[model samples]
Target: MCHHTQPVTGVPLNSCTSREKTSILQLLTLGMNSHTLPTCRVHHMEGRADPGRVPAAGGRPEEGDEADAEGDGPWPEAGDPRGEVGDFLSLDLGGTNFRVMLVKVGEGDAGQWSVKTKHQMYSIPEDAMTGTAEMLFDYISECISDFLDKHQMKHKKLPLGFTFSFPVRHEDIDKGILLNWTKGFKASGAEGNNIVGLLRDAIKRRGDFEMDVVAMVNDTVATMISCYYEDRQCEVGMIVGTGCNACYMEEMQNVELVEGDEGRMCVNTEWGAFGDSGELDEFLLEYDRMVDESSVNPGQQLYEKLIGGKYMGELVRLVLLKLVDENLLFHGEASEQLRTRGAFETRFVSQVESDSGDRKQIHNILSTLGLRPSVTDCDIVRRACESVSTRAAHMCSAGLAGVINRMRESRSEDVMRITVGVDGSVYKLHPSFKERFHTSVRRLTPNCEITFIESEEGSGRGAALVSAVACKKACMLGQ
Candidate 1:
């Protein structure tokens, strides 16, 4: 029984119902796996660093090489060929809105470089979002052409980096096969296809410009690499916004999908799909199942459905509905607006949690939702928000703890130090999410000394940086 037990992972298990306690415990189990969590597929960075000393196929690096240096970091060091000095174009297509960015990298003294960038955001139409692959890519190409025309650089063959923020299996830095779509995307003829190839075909059809598609990366990988520019110690990158996922540098030996066991490679842990194999079924609550069934990708991205911003608000609304039915909130009544799908946005969760106990903010928000919330009703809503958000924070922390602990053990260190680059509205904008998340991560990863750095323009900057690194490596390898 969880009764009378001390709290773990910052969640007061003693105060939780039996089902809630089980859910938290299952998350801990998922995070504490000793081996690489099979729930996430391994997508390497194609071994971006140490390009010259490429390892033989399916073989380990020669002993005494830096690849064999156990305690050394995985990122490239200073004074190396970072990238060619020039402007690179990067496309970031993660959500309904995609960004087209022009990044200028200029060399400075002592191998350091200065980067300047300008970007434009274009919204994807509802038809395009749910259309065929060709339609979607063609729309994206049109956006790219417009951006290039605005910059008056359509003729210059610039290196391009594509940041497709979805789950993918990479055959190389430049080739990623779309495993499946998440975040409400349902473009046909995309799954199991090479996303880069589709974009290339679309660009070729456009015929208005030429580009050298250099590299493609997930948003998490981009965040990690982008933050690596400011902090070389940042080897892990995590995103906790509309969706939750993470990436980290892993020892080559553990990445069974890749060939060589030489240097470390970045692995995109599409951890949002963590519970799809029914590992989480035993702990899932009624509200969770409701959200999952209603989502576009039902029975998918199950872990993300619990913690991502896209679902947090829905979860809270369901809880509120439950409370109302139990006569514990709103006098056992629900407004018509509250009954509507998506009337309660995720932002409401943040706003409700931010209320300072005066209940003014809570009353205003509920009133807008057509609810006449009393003082007691406002208090109950606030408590419900805290419970949902806290669970989300704790669950996210457990996943990150698993990654950090795995890194520490792989390096054979008792106390491993690392820095993580994180980005997302939920993590950055929430009133108490960062603190709650940090506390649980520390409790779960006792052997790690961790530093968290919030990323700025992670997807845009990261896509460009990935291209830069790939370009530099290619030049060295004479490829």
Candidate 2:
């Protein structure tokens, strides 16, 4: 619904004219090499900044302090800490879709289980995302009810694992205090609400189901758990889908949370806030600045905007709009539909760049937008995709590099063999995203051994695992 247009040439708006000229010169010199794009180098902008140092908190506790006060020992590891067989449910709540699944875990060779029911992906309405907490939870509860009924999972008091994919402050595994909304979700009353309580209330009201909401995990943490459950070598979990973020295991000794438990399981480090150091030499273009300035958590997640799927298409649009104003491409006529959200999805752009089918894909994209296109438009579209994606990939790599550097500084280990479990459409489906990220990581750490693994273990199943762990822990405490 956005109808904003780029200013025509010769119209000066604030410092945009100077910024645009600077960006153009930089782009001309860099050509197709996006690694050379100028980034904002301002140091210590405004926000809840990351200290860049490992926090004192170790692995999160099993329950709230009340559980600890009950003299309950640490939560039991999923299954036999050493063994690998258990049953869990995972619910992945993403920016655009909600996925739910039930999984059974077993040990090596015999350590296999069925998805029981196929995973369900329900598209979330935009209003639901930005509406009241009640409306949003009501919609989610309805979807969960339908899913349970369809799968015939109606009788059991199932322990549920909830993967709330947003930044949160957690006192333990069973709770997540919302920090702020991101990924375009501006729902009121949800920012500071307890996500677990909201979902539990919704589920209970919607289905009259007495389900125990056990663990509340982040998507990256769920990815780590899923990967570690499968392969012990998997140390890092990264999400490059709608938004970019990562989680990795940390030693208990390095975390301040565990004042006494220094010999415990690893803690999840929210690595998204790592690369905020103010030592940049590049320039942030006007559009990049605008996107950063207007984001829900502006000045934070700067790198995320550069790489995440949600912003890639917008970046391309801004660049294309600029090009149009300059008469470099798409000149003369402007496509009215191009200004809306998702007018040009990154996937479509990538297809336009890589498709070999007589430019059919480009034609289809243009047709969908009510924009007639000629053969010349194909080249323009392809170039735009390439330019935008390349920038995104480079930015992603830089973020990864920052993590690697931080890990090296903390652990000082020799090129630790780390496997990054990745989930999301951008990282999994996009043709150029993975390669570009890999290239950037290699540039930063030539000798560091790293592997990118796809996680079929989604949030829904992850949630189940968390539920199982929490239940097991609670039982030990006789709660």
**Highest TM-score model number:** 1
- Per-model TM against the reference: 0.82, 0.81
lDDT of 2 at 129: 88
The clash count for each model shown is 0, 15
Q: What's the residue-level lDDT of 253 in candidate 1?
A: 73
Local error of candidate 1 at residue 258 (angstroms): 2.7
Clashing pairs in 1: none
Model 1, 1-479: lDDT tens digits are 22222211233224545664454444333223322221221112122111222222111221111122233455545213255678899998877688999998887777677778999999999788899999999999999999999999998999998988887767767887887899888999999999989999999998989999988888887788788778878888899988988877778776555467776766666778777777567557888999999988999988888789989888888888876676555657899988887889999999998887667788789999998766556656776787778878877776788777777767799999899999888999999999988987887778889999999888778888767766876777796
Local accuracy of candidate 2 as per-residue lDDT tens digits, 219-320: 876776566556666766778888877665444445455454333334344434434443331445676777677666676656667677888777777666
Top candidate, metric lDDT: 1
Scored against the true structure, residue 423 in model 1 reaches a CA lDDT of 89
**Model 2 / residue 438 / CA error / Å:** 1.1
Error of 2 at 387 (Å): 1.5
Q: Which run of 10 residues does model 1 get worst, by summed lDDT? A: 57-66
